[model samples]
Target: MRALVLRHDHASQPGLVGDRLIERGYDLTTLTVVPEERFHSPDVTFAFPSAAEWDLVVSLGAPWSVYDEETIGTWIAGELALLREARDLGVPVLGICFGAQALATAFGGSVEPAPFPELGWTDVQSDIPDLVSSGPWFQWHYDRCVLPPGAVEIARNVAGLQAFVAGRSLGVQFHPEITAPVLRAWLDLDGGTLCARLGIDPDELVSRTLAERPQALARTAELVDAFLDRIALPVG
Candidate 1:
């Protein structure tokens, strides 16, 4: 099977998710919306492939807000169309964080600002621990998604909806695709700004991420494996 992995920025690569996909013998083709030259700039252009080409689509996390298509340009709409096409084709999709918000927007769902932004490791409540467990998952987004129509709510917390499944697709609010290297990159790049806004010490956040990453990333790999297996099954 082939997986189309979406990378919104250089820092937030698929991380552990990529490794698990490789182990499962799935070829990964990555699409970078914001290239290295415009990594900090929000002028992202997406050349989304047709849904029939890939067995599964995995949209990674991004720092940008999903609703700000004014600055991000028409690429947001293109991504949404691609997501919709994937759903229409019965191609399973796994959306993470900002990607989840994008998936929500693609399917008549809405993205709203959260009362409290989750910026570091935190535990969420999950309905299916066997598939999507409550976690000490890494989080960095300020917005949350309302489950789309026909979606099954799978996870939540004090913040709001954390995960849901719609047919073959799954949208998760946390970063189950995170790795220590990716975590460090995210911290080195965007952690300071979030720290100031959230009134958190950047150093403390980094320390906690580094210390807790081994276990957190392991669980993340497990979650990814479960999701892939579940969606990749042969249906009647």
Candidate 2:
């Protein structure tokens, strides 16, 4: 099967999730929205392919906020329309972090700044641990998704709703795609300063992520298995 990954920035490579998809026999091609020159820029103009061509779609996270329509309104508007069209066409979608926020916004829901952002490892609460487990999953987002219409919430934490399933789509607030080098790549790009401002030490976060690798892999394997067997496959 072919999986079209909507990559929004340089640091937001599919990482572990892409690895999982590869293991599951998926041919993955990422469509980068923000080009090299616009990689770090908030306002960008790009194109999204017709959703009918792919078996599955994944929208990865972005540094830019989904609600920043004043600046990226045009870009975000196009994305929302694309997502809505994908959903209408019954294409299964997996949305991560900012991607999830975009999914929420596309489906008659909303995204807003959280009371506080989740910067590092934080536990999640989910009744369906087989599909969604309590993490200490990697998190780095300032916004939260309000559940979309017909969306059944699958997970949560003190911060807010962590995951939900809508039609053929699964949206999660945490980053299951994180890895040591991925974390390092993000750190290389002002992650240290960003964490420091939040009173989190980047080195410590990196250390924890490194330590969490083995278990994280296994966890993501389970996540992908269930996501494929349950969320994507059933519909696909």
In the range 27-55, model 1's lDDT, one tens digit per residue, is: 99998888767866777666788988999
Per-residue alpha-carbon lDDT of candidate 2 for residues 1-236, written as tens digits (9 for 90 to 100): 99999988777689899999999999999988877566556577767788888888999998878988665647888888889988988888899999999999999999988889889988899978888888778899989999998999989998899999898788999999998888887888778878878888888988999999888988888887888888875542
For model 1, the superposed segments whose C-alpha errors exceed 4 Å read 232-234
- How does each model score on lDDT? 0.83, 0.87
The best candidate by TM-score is 2
Residue pairs that clash (backbone atoms under 3 angstroms), model 1:
none
> What TM-score would candidate 2 get against the native?
0.96
Instruction: Give the Cα error of residue 136 in candidate 2, in Å.
Output: 2.0
Q: Mark the regions of model 2 whose C-alpha exceeds 4 Å error after superposition.
A: 234-236
**Model 1, residue 98: C-alpha shift (Å):** 0.8
Cα deviation at 155, candidate 2, in Å, is: 0.7
